[model samples]
Target: MAGVISGHPLDTLRIRLQQPSSSSSFSALKVLRSMASSEGPLALYKGMSAPLASVAFQNAVVFQVYAVLSRAFDSRNGRDPPSYKSVVLGGVGTGALQSLILCPVELIKIQLQLQKQASRGLGPMGLIRRIMEREGVKGMYRGLAVTALRDAPAHGVYFWTYEYTREHLHPGCRQCEENTTTTLTLGKMLVAGGVAGVASWVCCYPLDVLKSRLQGEPAAYTGILHCFRKSVREEGPAVLWRGLGTAVARAFVVNGAIFSAYEVALRCLSSYQGGQSPSPAAE
Candidate 1:
């Protein structure tokens, strides 16, 4: 929740800048200034409710699924620490499962964030009702296919990088051992999570841009391939990375907070449970 709140402004700008008709000259700072001056400072937090409401549920599902799959893979391989291949497969499973819940939540969030005028004050529930009335249940999942495509490989990279970084950063530390609820310093957790977040985004940002475009109103492109081709042909390849600056910044802050919080919570819970800590490793 804290991470989402901290990074939402950047996400709003990223979504806007990914739009087909968005100006090429728009920077994150420029977008921030424009939104503040034209609307209000609070405008940056538009569409925050949906994400805040769903983030816990979303993360719970992803981590649980990833852990289960990773354990299964490790058992099959008869390995104590799972191979990179197993980690990637677990991540893919996590992403695929999470997408089913994320699609509708994101569809609502993108719509609310992209709204320019206060006159069109459609809250999340209102927008959901409107989508259902106009386009049926499927409308809520406007970009599920692209979302799955983006998330699968992105999460594969995300979890793999996080685990790989944790092991290297804290070499020989029992805390870094798999299936241990060992507490890590906040700094270590931040570094690992930050790298994971940035790697995930950098690897799959273009797909995200396309997914946003397909979900947003006044849809310009027909499908994923058409969106890619049209964007490159008309706007050039640079357009695909329009909001990368803000995204990277957000990744570092939000993911750092996420991992730190996860570690802290696990440690506290373990301490509370008569010093019997469960493994903090998602795997």
Candidate 2:
């Protein structure tokens, strides 16, 4: 869960940058520096608990479901192994399902991070109460549509690119090549994960922008379509790319670490389950 833990702080910063009006009335960089100065390095990590929980649960479920669905697709199709299409579909399904499950926790995390003194005077508890009282249980899923749309395709890119990279990098596919080994080399994993990150970001950026706006400042956006039209009309086309640099950087770091960790973890788990010594090639 290093990704879930370390990444939320950046997630908080991304949210802050995307919705500058939600925080102080300063430029994005200035507000970020101000928060660092005022609240110490730790301040950037507000509302981290929910993400930790969410990511831990999300990764577990996504990985498990992806494996199961991909294998099932392969078995049903009578292919020797699953095709890349199966992997993409599995990733998409896992992402959509996880987004639906994690939306409430995600909404609370964003609301906690974004609530300004002048806006609503709502603390975390107050925000939760207000949402529950006014919008009912469904209010916690405010940005779920955008999240699912973004994640399904984004994850499809991730899985497809990841497998494609591994397949290409390996010498042969018959014996589960070195690239697919549990102890996959750091360099290959980094390259694969980095490419996947770019693939995901490029394909899903518009949806991500919509999700960020919806989560960080709901009032600023009536809905996804309205947000898109208003953004295009008012802020020029570049509005959809707000905070893209930071997002790219965040994705590079976070997704790289996530992929590496996931591969390493899966190797360990698989070895453990098989009652075998850890593969030296894996480490």
Question: Against the correct fold, how does model 2 do in TM-score?
Answer: 0.85
Query: For candidate 1, lDDT tens digit of each residue in 218-265?
Result: 367678888889888888999889899888989988987887777666
Candidate 1 wrong stretches, greater than 4 Å: 76-79, 173-183, 274-283
Total backbone collisions for each predicted model: 0, 1
At residue 15, candidate 1 shows an lDDT of 89
TM-score of 1: 0.90
Candidate 2: residue 258 lDDT (0-100): 73
Reference-based lDDT, each prediction = 0.83, 0.73
Predicted candidate 2 versus true structure: per-residue lDDT over 40-80, tens digit per residue = 66667777767766677677788899888777766454535
The prediction achieving the highest lDDT against the true structure is 1
What are the models' TM-scores? 0.90, 0.85
The alpha-carbon lDDT assigned to residue 160 of candidate 2 equals: 93
